[model samples]
Target: MAVPHYAYLKMKLLGPKGLIIVVGDYCKSLECAQAGAKLAESLVIAEEQRQLDRIVALANETPAVPALAKEPAGEASFQPSKETKKVKLKPEDPSCSKYVIVGTRLDNK
Candidate 1:
């Protein structure tokens, strides 16, 4: 067993020739700690990237559905079925513009 002295960066252990002292370089220790932190960060980033890639793969596996196929538009066929009359905003300025297509279903009594 050894007694660690953090302030001096030394460890004292009982040896045949009295007490054995182990010394650590402060700069080297700092570099090692920083390197460990960087390694941890890189590992975390790699794990996150893997998760994202798996999500992308799952997304790709699903069949793609076209926008037009999803909601079949009936606008073209529906226009003929509805009896609509155009009401001009300004009756004086008549040039086939600024008119609302008002349905006559409400007036049909």
Candidate 2:
């Protein structure tokens, strides 16, 4: 069995002949730990970039607008639930053209 002492940066074990010891340099350990942390951060950023790319690929996707039910007065009527707001794309955002923004956090229905 091997026992490690992190504070002393040493590992001790019983060898076939006698007691064996391993030592670690503090500076080297610090450098290696920093490199490991950077690698982990890069991996997370790469994953996020892949997800962003997938979402961006659907830039041309258009949401289906369900036909609103007509009232007895022959007028299309749609009153969103009190918790939801039905908003048409505003002229201020020309890029959003025919898009509708639902105020509620609902799945794309």
Candidate 3:
């Protein structure tokens, strides 16, 4: 017997445990096959995004440890031993004229 002109599209929806939940073994048209594949792809992408969001939320909810708490016992206090040299900017400098810094340190703190 001669095969039909229409191609067959086999689709299987798998669960997290690798178990098959839904199957579509026969599709009459190319459009239907493509639509089914696109739908499955979108669903997989959405599920992955949801899982990522859940992981991020769990990480955010976890309590963060203080920087000092992680230090070993008998460690000296944190301090910069070397003095930092001050950089003076000239008004006539070409690079300085291109940008302006207006914010105060208090605003940042």
Q: What are the models' TM-scores?
A: 0.49, 0.53, 0.34
Error of 3 at 79 (Å): 39
lDDT of each: 0.86, 0.82, 0.59
* Candidate structures ordered by TM-score, highest first: 2, 1, 3
In Å, residue 31's CA in model 2 sits off its true spot by 0.5
Clashing pairs in 2: none
Candidate 2 segments whose C-alpha is farther than 4 A from its true place: 62-109
Residue-wise C-alpha lDDT for candidate 3, range 61-102, written one tens digit per residue = 876754555665455856443534333356577576344334
Best-fitting candidate, scored by TM-score: 2
Model 3 clash pairs are none
Compared with the true structure, the alpha-carbon lDDT of candidate 3 equals 0.59
Better of 1 and 3 by lDDT: 1
Off by over 4 Å in 3: 1-28, 64-109
Model 1 misplaced stretches (Cα beyond 4 Å): 62-109
Give the lowest summed-lDDT range of ten residues in model 2: 73-82
In candidate 3, what residue range of length 10 has the lowest lDDT sum?
A: 1-10
The TM-score of predicted model 3 comes to 0.34
In terms of TM-score, which candidate is stronger, 2 or 3?
Answer: 2
Q: What TM-score, to 2 decimals, does candidate 1 have?
A: 0.49
In angstroms, the error of model 2 at 24 is 0.4
